[model samples]
Target chain A: MVASSTARTGAGGQTLVVDLAYPPDPGRAPFTRADLVVTGVDHSGTSYEVRLYLDNPGADIDTPRDPEAGYAGRYTVFGHGGCYGDEGHCEVPEAAGDPTDVRPVHQLTPLDTFVTVTDALRRVLDRDGRLSTVTMVPVSLTPRRSDRSPAPELLEFADLSLHTYLAATDLDVPTPG
Target chain B: MGVRRSAASLSVAELTDLRDAFTALYGISDDRGYAFLAGVHGLPLPQYCKHGSILFLPWHRAYLYFMERAMIDALRRSRDDPAAAVSLPWWDWSSAAAHADGGGLPPGWLAPADGGANALASGPMTLGDADLEQVRTNLPGAVTDGADPVTVRDPDTPDQLPKATTVNRALSATSFTEFSQIVEGIHNGVHGWVGGAMSAVPIAAYDPIFWSHHAMIDRLWYLWQLSPQGADPSAALLDTALPPWPMTVRQTLSVPNLGYDYAAQVVG
Candidate 1:
């Protein structure tokens, strides 16, 4: 995977974005798993700038758990966590744009999807200029719990931040060839 | 290269060997030694744990292989037989889930600690107390990351156990991603079911059942690999290196490459 580094500077703040292009693996569809676009990265050497979690789907290795449960407004309690809905209906990364623009990945691989820090996190960029933490929500999810029937967060996640394996490495930084 | 058998199917001797081997490994304190085996799944940096990604099956397969190798070696030592026939066993929770009283907990795990080394109880944990903690070895020197490392297992945490039928459904998936979603979903359900120390993600490996549970999950994947419908990653996904993992997804697909098969599946 060859990548190029680019930082987007805006009035709000600076987002270190990396574009990663993976070579064709074999008989897979062309570009089906092509470029990985990561935004809101810290890009500073050492420490993690970005973290990716798969919610209940991609929790971690060795430990497998109940997917339907959560705790608190969003605290992961017992088998389940905070949400009162199902992770199945949540369309993340895509819905990242706005509440209504969310689209589900369906049975497709998440390779084409873009992952970014959803909102401004005070701790996102450390004093050293590296990303501190990132929390992702399905595009339609509001930090405040929704009282509707189709709430994706109702069953999607309490916290997925711990699922990533690439922490403490430059893997999140897409270096340009 | 030994076959992994179901715990219920193991003869008295085989079970004893497994218990002894685990006890031996559990007693070791060195990070690079036996503790390292379990720590691979726990702290000292849970670097190779691949969750929420395509490498889920492969990474655990490799990690299981290493731990199983350690078990086999330890078992051989326990029996003092250079050629001792010992292998790690798996818990068929999917089948157990079907039983009226199966999914609660394996009786073997809760066996009364009548002056015997209890594997499930974490009695006198030799790996730096019960925490199974570690310092960062990836860097030049070990340092505290100040991460919370604890283990918990609550029997009632899981809402539903993965039935054999559910696993069969996963096997029925036509795509690798589809199969993983269902299979891994069931996998997550069980982890939550065995709450307590098991509920904690980073330190769950400290529980004895964690290994057996994963064996079942790996066996399911192996079963899928044997089927004609089994899907392998295409070139598009092949190059996606499972970071912190030494191997690729394509490399971990073949069970034979790792040198093991399910005991029950082999017909001679």
Candidate 2:
């Protein structure tokens, strides 16, 4: 499903600030891993990076990329720059109209990106049982030569959600045969 | 069929063969040349390599196969022993050996050769007029500044590499889509962690280490396929063609059928 949220980047790039509601159930055991599940990332434009931080909204390209500064992690998008084909050629393919139809999805279809912020998440939780926010700063890279006059949209995505997983139980690990 | 061993397991003789193979390919500036093959992934007009897509795994599998065959052929032509060529060695980033230093890159990958430059560490990039023009116009200032452009790497600390738990988490995924997304996300992190040209798609392949890093990703997928919970992509997706290569997704499913297999594929 396509997410509705999208962030269009500007000259210095746009920073996405999200207020997170997490720690679903206090009764459950602590999470072993925390992943920032970014869904439906739009990479049809220039390649770029999105730096993730726990609570540092002011984080930018110059910000110290370390755990002490709330730096969680980052991921890069090797984009297509822009469609080089005829009109509609680069458009994301719509779902097959008929279930009987048998064709693979388009190669340019939007995909999900995940960044594991386990250490960062744990630090926030340990300090104040409840974690509150996440900051994602988008940094734009070079665009297609023809469209270089004005900066192009560098970042766009469908959704942002926090997914936490519990530690593996004894049953999950297999015993030696 | 030859077995692709981990970079850490390669013998001194095997390392010499790989270095020789790459050195031979470096001279040839044609389609079979290292620069040309690297360009097929990104840079110039068409970047055929699949990223952030379902075809990511299969496409790279085919690309690796193509490059290995080219390397083998080059070795056969250059040396007296036709068997001198060795299967490409993969950098097993998830192993303890890789986590030993601040950065896990194999010594051979970054080590100098003899008293000269190391082909594996870096190589010259010879882009055609058209490719060079594209770089100048669109990808300004991306290449290294020097008399000649060469592939470069600015890697991050070992802590930045994906942890073993993250890889195991990806392997536990039941569906191909979920598996692809998680693995690709990990793949993207490595690229970013490597930094410099490796971080960018346009010139990433030019770096020789790009091959080993990718082999690790491909190996993980192979392990996943062997797991009981693993399943192939949907029928329609399997039948789809991976562009720029004749092979389909179904064709890339079997590693042995492709004439190679990983030496140690025991999943953690």
Candidate 3:
């Protein structure tokens, strides 16, 4: 398996603080790059936007158009049924949507984006030597539902799935070769 | 006004008698017991079940609710009939401590025999330390050591299990906001799939109380759905897929087709 490594260093007496924003309540929805705020110390000590991209594909609700569209499509349907309606509009039933298409062609925030951003941050910190602590804040990205209402906020499930995803980035492991 | 009997007041014998009546009503026998029981629990047999699926919570809740309702109905029927010979018995786990302590005749308690030596009897006979260890490791924060506080009582009885007592206390002590917080703590990480397609996780079958615990969990989910605070947003998202066989919500919602119904008042 191919492994990737990155590091950031603290420069000239300044401490590098990595604040990872997460939703205060994780059960509401998942955090995405769109919900991120990455600021780090540059050479002049000014906070700059450290471009963040996760290693996973962009976050898209997986609505499969075909048989092979797989697990993502199923999750999309389930989530769709769960949050189909808005304040005034009635929720759409799963059957009301088009069939024969196993997957829906919706824009998705890839899981890898988080990994990529974390990798980049690690590399920068390793290079700078001013790195201090890393903090993660879970935040919510709006869902592209028909209602266009704000996505409900979420609290993270206290499970290994998300933790493992974050750990892979923290450790700077490459996508397994 | 007439006094009402709640699930919280059933005895173990009453619960067992109800189980038998339901089994008879459905023509269930030992040969097809698992499938019948699975139906009672709103699950397809393991052979039809997918590994690492999200159906765990909803499916099991449906199953237990069916059982609770069946038991409740049977008790009411028995109360109205002079010919009714069997009464509901409650397996009060809190009383187990006193029973162990040599206290005479723990109240609202019944011996395991009333269950007719079924799979649930194994729960009292063996501890299965290894299984308990796995359950502990996977599900941290389980109350361990002091006494076997996990009670399996007929839903119609008020016999209190220690764990149920604690849960009741927590629910009663907290304001609605605090209760919501407490529930959230328990509900977190609750949605996940365990085991792969090839391997089966036997945790569901480890004890008979697994059904009841899951029933309680489902009840919490129902309550959460109705809470003014809002349903768990994460729950709104489907992170998993339906199995290959095409199924619709209509197919799933029908009780006779599924072979059971939710207790009349429980869902309300």
Q: Candidate 1 regions off by >4 Å?
A: A1-177, B31-34, B96-98, B113-116, B120-152, B157-159, B239-246, B265-268
Runs in model 2 deviating more than 4 A are A1-14, A20-35, A44-48, A53-74, A79-110, A115-132, A139-153, A162-177, B111-115, B136-142, B146-148, B265-268
Question: What tens digits encode model 1's per-residue C-alpha lDDT throughout A23-136?
Answer: 212411222111123322211111111222221222221122221210001111112111112454222333355768433222112221132121111122122222322222
List where candidate 3 sits over 4 angstroms from the true fold. Answer: A1-177, B1-8, B16-27, B30-32, B39-56, B65-119, B123-206, B231-268
Best by DockQ: 2
Q: What CAPRI class is candidate 3?
A: incorrect
- Candidate 2, residue A51: the lDDT equals 77
Ranking according to DockQ, highest score first: 2, 1, 3
Tens digits of per-residue lDDT for model 3 on A1-177?
Answer: 112222222222121223222222332232111112111111111001111222212222222222121111111000111111134222222443667766522211111111112333333334543222332222111111121221212211111112213221112322110
Q: What does fnat come to for each candidate?
A: 0.03, 0.20, 0.00
DockQ per candidate? 0.04, 0.21, 0.02
- Ordering by TM-score: 2, 1, 3
Query: iRMS of candidate 3, one decimal?
Result: 20.9
Worst 10 residues of 1 chain A by lDDT: A69-78
lDDT of 1 by residue, B162-215 (tens): 555556656766667756654655665566556544543344576677888888
Best-performing candidate as measured by TM-score: 2
